[model samples]
Target: MYEYKCVELRSKMFGGALSGDKLERVLNEWAAKGWQLKSTAAVDVKGRIGPGGTDGLLITFERQKG
Candidate 1:
């Protein structure tokens, strides 16, 4: 069996550009905890002060649950 996790990566730039450095950091952090990236999906995520959503990525990870 395995466990799965979903993480949202939001763009901090004004022009809606995703940070590569941040992405690498998150991937490494989760990998250190035994999680491997399974998939990703581009999405528009709702923000705290926004009427519409912003561009973001939905990252999925999986790990053995034994």
Candidate 2:
């Protein structure tokens, strides 16, 4: 069987774009721990004090369970 992990990535800048560098860093970090990318999805996450939501990414990873 396999295990999975999910991570939510939000833009650091307000009304700006998500950082490619940040995404790469997270991918590499997980890779180092033997996790392989499973999938990614775009989503709008609601904020604490807003009627709207913020753009974000839902990253999923998987690895064989030992």
Q: Number of backbone collisions per candidate, in order?
A: 0, 0
Highest lDDT model number: 1
- In candidate 2, what are the lDDT values of residues 1-66, reduced to their tens digit? 999999887664324677778788889999999999999999887767869778889899999999
- Full-model lDDT for every candidate: 0.86, 0.85
Candidate 1, residues 9-28, lDDT tens digits: the string is: 87854256667777888899
- How does each model score on TM-score? 0.82, 0.79
Clashing pairs in 2: none
Which ranges of candidate 1 are over 4 A from the true structure? 13-16
Model 1 steric clash pairs? none
Local distance difference test, candidate 2: 0.85
